[model samples]
Target: MISQAAYGAEPNKDRRIPVTVLTGFLGAGKTTLLNAVLSETSSGKIAVIVNEFGEAGLDHDLIESVEDEIILMQSGCLCCSIRGDLAGTIADLIERRDDGFLRFERIIIETTGLADPAPILQTLLIDPELARTTRMDGLVTVVDAANGSKTLDAQFEAVSQVAMADLILLSKTDLISAKVTDALSMRLNGLNPTARIERPVAGQFDPKQLWGLSGLRKGVRQEDAIAWTTSAPEPKIDPLANLSGLSKPKPVSFAPTPHDTRISSASIVLDTPIKDSAFDYWLDTLIALKGPDILRVKGIVFLEGIDVPFVFHGVQHIFDPPVPLKNWIGDDRRSRIVVIARDLTRPELQRSLDMLRAHQPKTGTKEEVLLGHD
Candidate 1:
């Protein structure tokens, strides 16, 4: 959990609102899940910004019809459309909220079905005012269990959505068999090993599950931190000779799909603390050369001469400022970094780490030899 101090001061001192980006492909039950969230009275006042108001099936009784663009829900929530500019829309909401015209605890942005989440995530990090006033809580993606495999096989966008998700809600599970749903879950795990996958009951889930999902915040548990930055090891393949050949079994061929080969998810662990210069140089070079292909990079870094470790997060080229875990305890000092990239292989990423290791500051001076005097 991120304490109020994580935002730099007390809650009253820092009014940075947390924003959650909700996204999914067409017919993935995004609307159903969103409606469930809004209908739940236990969920605090939430301001929802949708790409299109006409398409969002918000309850009529809840909407007070404030204006052409804004609809005030009886539950004390606000609903608005993008009106062409996301940043401008959010800025207006902030102004109104400050002026006592609106009330909401957090903001949720729902993107179009075909939307790519990378650009939306970049906007939050790149916009100065947005970055100052709002912090990204996390990204929640809805996947249709019945059609997930077909969608992934047909649309790379759907695959990308699965890859960049922090929380994946498997919707429409009731429409499919358990065997099929389990297969989809395994595929999702392969696409993104870090994301938490849940099969929401009847397309409904607790709103609280969406909050504080970054896992890079202060006061977070060490296990949670490790889970967020560590990738599961690839399954080992055994030799065919080990199998029983009493009946002369048929030969098996192994092949990976194009999508699987395109996106690579891997992690590297370093035993020693990294020098400041070396870490910066390696990150800068990697982002400069492969920013577009890079989807997400997150890590817990322990720098030389620094007592507390810094948690860093990045989406492509844009990155949030590293926050120090002042209260972090334990003697485990290994640095761990996870990267999800497109068209980048594990060996390539390893080579980049090798560069960082090669550039590390040399330690200990050797004593001068007295061979000449002897």
Candidate 2:
């Protein structure tokens, strides 16, 4: 863990304090970047919110921000309780600042590797109270240049993070050759084209570049919507192309890799509004049976009685209540739901969703709809 004395940033007082959410896969150098920024000598006072202080056991270091840390996160990923906790923490921080207990000009939230950043971003964006004081600056994701391709192939979490990033940081360039680094960058660009790619030389880069990421400062507009919806370009070179020399030709399939063969994602769009009761029954039944296998579930639903779209985010068995959006941002009014899970298939999820929309009672022999069964 980076000591508090080592972390510093130049404060910006001219605008509303921007809250940046830092995310990446496990061992993507997030801690290293946090340490680098926090340990460095600067004029800004930045407050950092982490899941737990014991994960890396840095609480004993006697750092400067110990009292300032928000310990609201659970041992695992951020989920149901996190929305309220995050809102409360930010509100508390603002209160303390108002009382002159905190002098920080900016804030950064470092999420766990397995954590999904969508809910956190939504909380900052939709929470009326938090939005008044702090706006979402941007989402910065770190990718390990040397082994990032394999990580992305194996972990849906990594792919989602890359897909959602405003800025992709290619870390540890010094450990890999230019060819490998360039190939990884190409792969990343294929995943997200609008994100600015930054390469850190010797694990160092200017902190200023991380702030002021476009589109996230306010709410999701047409431009912000386009950033996520843009089509990814095809890779110039296959990441596994160089490995053909020592191994036999690999079998071709629709699967990404054997590592993530059990993990899959499915997107569903419903043209008609769903009754709240039917939606709840479907979600409750699905989560009750397959919660552990479900990694992350997020969607915007056009409920029958609601004029505005409702957003919901879930991790494992824990889920936050649906949050109503102010209004639909784009012309597309179809309700969209994206589910990522382990040992799951798109057909099974789509079937489950269909059953839910129909309000059909679950049959005991429905094991075929779940992963690892049929």
Candidate 3:
């Protein structure tokens, strides 16, 4: 039997701080968003960490230089640049907060433009001390609407950033035409069907909207779980008919680039409850074989003989503890899993899921009890 501890299951003893990882390719307007969040008085107390404090443009009067390491902001927030190790920097911050030196409710780490966010996420999951003190709130990626398509075609890092984001903030929309924005949105939707896409209004966004994005959080609702696991419906484009009654304009479609082709997102649905053994085998085999290629995996599973369903989330090979929805009450018992991977096809994922379905309880199989039916 697989123990719950193996899945990283444990009850929270105290309120762990929430951390948001912000990432984007070069010139994606991440700095602008950070400035907006820091300058706004209503954003509450936040701790912002970056690779270089100078490059972040901390010129706003709301920010007051405290010391070489940390800068105190007038909005009751703090901004600092990472000195050495990320884990160490976070540990120091936590220590200060516990020692009554700093006051902040959330932490945001802005990665360099060329950085991949998966490794950072893996660190948060595997590190025992960090996991106990912090919870992953969400991954927010900023994409420049005008140059996003070309960036995706040229850089695999940008593609990975978009693929792994829970909330994508589309920047530079005002500079691009409406048609261009729609095409880029379509491309992003194809890359990450489960992510929530939003265009920040005039380089401004509500800091509150970025929190509590993880669907596997404690006391998660059924609707939130379904929203996180299910893919967005394919958009419908109506044919445009001219007044001359001639042929209608065909729908606009963005062709997948080479980099875009490298990443694929697909969801699997099983009508019946999956046996625990089946789920364990399928997940273990899949992770063992394609762990490096998997960018993200999330599911709401209904296991046989278990009354309540559980929500599981994973990044690459490391998985967060499965959260059981004991309060779930409804007729829906179907299991849904969404996988986003690089160099993995939908057929390959389906084949693995087939193994789980094959293990479902068969009629009269238990009655036979290791004896020949004949």
Candidate 4:
């Protein structure tokens, strides 16, 4: 049987419409990112789906179609969904486009502040009906730089949203110190090593960086995949060096502690290549025991016999098949895996991993590798 995802495809152009799910906590600058994309002149014919028109209200020249929910803007973009469930709404939009009523090159679904992105992602990835017509481009999560740390600690939804994103936009950086921003960036990176964190100055960013990120497409470059799986940069200390204890009467810092943590990240870089079966077994055992606690797992693995490195992605218990790259990108060929979880300390997770034959031979059975807030 022909797969539904391959049926009635458009000619010349790729038939699958790329959809970006935009999510963030309340006042995390999601609306700001949306406005930036909408206002940018170089953007394509993008279709936007928001939960409330009032929340995303912006002044743009209107085209002919101005329904209660769906409004076509003069910038070759369409705004949709006054209020409804996401799955049904997206299906309706696809139907309209198929029927020649709507035209757009891509789609962006701006989710509510309190939304858990996993379900939205599940629909995009596995829903056969929608999967046929549309492909999930990537998730762009907006994070408030000034208040992000506290928000992540308090709200599980915010953590999950950040954990699952393909790209994270750090907004309102100007409102906070570079040290604070650096600290927040490190925390986010620990939570999700697979995502690229970008700072948007005054809600302005290049639209091209936000879209075309679905790893399944033919147009998806190997460079993008490598970039996604690469480790995050360490936070700089020099930015915070000016705050002296004697001069400033000692500054108070809420910087992360070794185990004060409910949610934390662990990234392991293996000096030697791992056997495929051994690596698989390690992951299976880890997830089976703590699937509910594990929020996200992503990495580039270098297998013993394989010439190419494969990228692995997992959300809770569900794991996507590893994607093999055409060639290694740079000089660094070591295998790196990052895990973000709740109530699991980096040391405990590392101990479990140290037991794996991939890194074993047991040098005291302790977790030597640490990631996030290092």
**Number of the top-ranking candidate, with lDDT as the measure:** 3
CA-lDDT, candidates in order: 0.76, 0.61, 0.80, 0.70
Candidate 2's residue-wise lDDT over 68-113, tens digit each?
A: 2442221111111123488887787778778976567777888889
lDDT of 4 by residue, 3-62 (tens): 122223224445778889999999998776776677665767888998887787656544
Of 2 and 3, which scores higher on TM-score?
A: 3
Better of 1 and 4 by lDDT: 1
Tens-place lDDT per residue, model 1, 1-374, is 11223334323233578899999999898878777777666778988999887778777866666775788777677789897689989999998889988888899999988899988888887889998889887999999989988888888888889889998888987886565676677677778887888888963478789887886565666777777777543222223333453454333332346876677876766666777767887889999999898889888888877776778889898888776666668888778777788888777776776675575444421111110100
Clash count, predicted structure 2? 7
lDDT of 3 by residue, 1-374 (tens): 23333344446533888899999999998888887888776757999989997678776677776865899988888998887888888988999999999999899999999999998898888888999898888999999999999999999999999999998888998897655776788788888888888888874578777777788887767788788887755443323323343575444568778788788766667777777777878888989999999999888887877777788889989998778877788887878887888887766766766676576544411110100001
Model 1 stretches with alpha carbons more than 4 Å out = 1-14, 218-221, 232-256, 359-374
Predictions ranked by TM-score, top down? Answer: 3, 1, 4, 2
Total backbone collisions for each predicted model: 0, 7, 0, 0
List TM-score per model, in order. 0.85, 0.55, 0.89, 0.77
Give me the overall lDDT of model 1. Answer: 0.76
Cα lDDT of candidate 4 equals: 0.70
Models, CA RMSD each: 9.2, 11.8, 6.6, 5.6
lDDT of 3 at 108: 93
Residue pairs clashing in model 4 are none
Question: What's the TM for model 2?
Answer: 0.55
How displaced is residue 220 in candidate 2, in Å?
3.4
